[model samples]
Target: MHNFEEATSAFAKASDAISLKVNFPRTKHSAMGLKPYLTKTVWVLSVISLLTDIASEMLYPVMPLYLKSIGFSVVLIGILEGVAEAVAGLSKGYFGKFSDHSGRRAPFIRLGYSLSALSKPMMAMMVYPLWIFFARTIDRLGKGIRTGARDALLSDEATHATKGRVFGFHRSMDTAGAAIGPLLALWYLYAHPGAYRPLFLLAFIPGVLAILLSLSLKDRQPKPSGKRQLPALFSFLHYWKDSPPAYRKLLTGLLLFTLCNSSDVFLLLKVKQAGLTDTAMIGIYIFYNLVYALAAYPLGILADRLGVRKVFTGGLLIFAVVYAGMTVDGGGAWYGLLFFLYGLYAAATEGISKAWISNITDKADTATAIGTYTGFQSICTMLASSLAGWIWYRQGANTVFAVTTAGVMGVWIYFLVVLIPEQQKSPGQGG
Candidate 1:
């Protein structure tokens, strides 16, 4: 086990490696002197995300294997994941709303990271199914608690013009951690085969580092709002009705698209059906993450240069092509190309959507607006996965792929016809 001092030292080293020292240039976007997009807060928050993801991903690949070893059936494992995800998804909105009402981001950020860090060792110490479920829920719950506030924190750091760049850079760093985490797990498991318990404890190192970094953030008190009324647990749902027309329009398109976007597991399963080796599948997934990490920042910059709506619509086009490609029979090489394109699709949409939303909504409502969308987004994702599974099991993979492709086209049309026009008519809503 790493001692506190060793963990702190590792955190310092990582901070030094990932830290950005930006020399902002005066541009049309910032004619009144440069607004530092890559602020210290942005980089610090991103580093915290990178470290936490590393910790979580290190355990993710081995989770099922470990669960089975501890006597959980396939059905039980599925139930565990479903429930854990539901908890995480629902809490994102509640906590996000709570953070906004309280006018504090740092406390939620700190508590969320701390809970996740503490959950690591708890997993290693227990083998009971209930205990494992409890620990897993804690891990995911931490994600829900922090997501809105963290993104809002990122949003607060940059202006409308720089939102895409800020978010894109953060996504790049976060995905880089995802890539690094699984490799580290593979390395450890290679050296000490079947030593999964100790690996859980080992993941704690990076998690602790994340928590320590989160603690350093100082909260800025937001201006007091007129209404301090406490929201219901599911009160974020009400935000949809009260939010701006542009926000509602954008969210409708986003949610409609999300309803068609299923889990990435289906993609892996597709390649598996093509007779690729396990090693090849893992390598391909890592390659996809690397592509996403590399492309996110550049695509974000492109979105800033062009328009966020344009780039986001372009991503949907890419999605349509990828799914259409999947319908054709492809071997490993062709599948590789599709996955690479898929990564680009993710990079273009994920951060860019949030940037788009932040630009159009009131700053005071940043967390609430994002929280509601993400909250419903999570539910839509669950439904999409279930619907896709049924279609794949009944109709077949190619049929599901075709269906998804058609859905993407419909969404693309809706964006061009409806959402874009709505944004254009609204004052100061262009991003």
Candidate 2:
């Protein structure tokens, strides 16, 4: 009961912290600059993402180091990440389809965030490989549950014209938390010097706050359809056939790109292998996210005005350059530039792809379409990470990166020649 009381108090405080007048006043002079493109729901959801990402990213930069400290090899780490991502990928489809089928979004959001919140503390409680995997899977399971529904909520909140700005603003806010979380971890690690366990518990604070904030969101539930069959585990796969040809074409390029774009952990590991300290590694990560946070919204606006296809493909080009740069023998100096470009790559592609997908799909199937795409994307990411890890183990990091750079170039050409032309002719080019 005392613990319950403490949680209630925490919720009240978090609610107050997020109140419009206090934090993001609705006035013209508001900190975030109130705009018609961003609605209350969008703001609320962004804050939830911001808080949740803080919790997740706090652990992210250190995860590889922590695993190594516990005697995990690079290959083992790769397998673990691959498996965890696979679980999240598969479930993203199922839950996304389930959310669409149920005509409700808020319940899934609430449950998902809560599970993620609980998983934060779970990581600090035990050191066993199975226990760690279980905790990590819970964290990713929460992500799978909410991503499609949450993104659909964002999609519903904006028109095709405004999708870029809305999603961009949300990404900006979310990445801001990503920046802040790592900084906090960096500070904690500086003072404590390798005391990683306590940081996991610290992450739980923001996660709980995210859950509390998410509670305020109310889904516009559609009236029930009469049929009552449950969605199949891989039912979201069916959307591939039902989706527009443009969506399928775009997704083909995207999935191919993902097949080479391995986990970011490999990047951090690269820095570590170069003899950089933990502080230096986290510092580089912090810089990358800061660049991403700063660039995401402005780039989103650009995508809206110029064209999402232009912006997304341009980002891919940057991605190729960054990967190519990664093949160089430069020290911290070159890494900073590469990560800056990488950040730009992330800002351009991540939200813009979703906005593009949402624009092309029927409104009713928004969740299913995105769920299926991301679900497949995640599976591809798993394979990519595993493959990169194996290559790093046998051949070398340079070979892994070189292969990725070549893949990105091919994907970029595919997007420009194949996907873009098809999108232009498609009926859904409204964005």
lDDT tens digits, residue span 313-372, model 1: 999999999999988887889999999999999999999999988888877778888887
lDDT for each residue of candidate 2 in 95-209, tens digit (9 for 90 to 100): 8899888888888889889999999899889989889889989988999999888988898877666687678888988999999988788778879988988889999999999
Candidate 1: what lDDT? 0.85
Q: Highest TM-score, which number?
A: 1
Q: Where does candidate 1 have its weakest 10-residue lDDT segment?
A: 15-24
Q: What is the C-alpha lDDT of each candidate?
A: 0.85, 0.83
Q: Give the candidate number with the greatest lDDT.
A: 1
RMSD of each: 5.9, 7.4
**lDDT for residue 62 in candidate 1, whole number 0-100:** 91
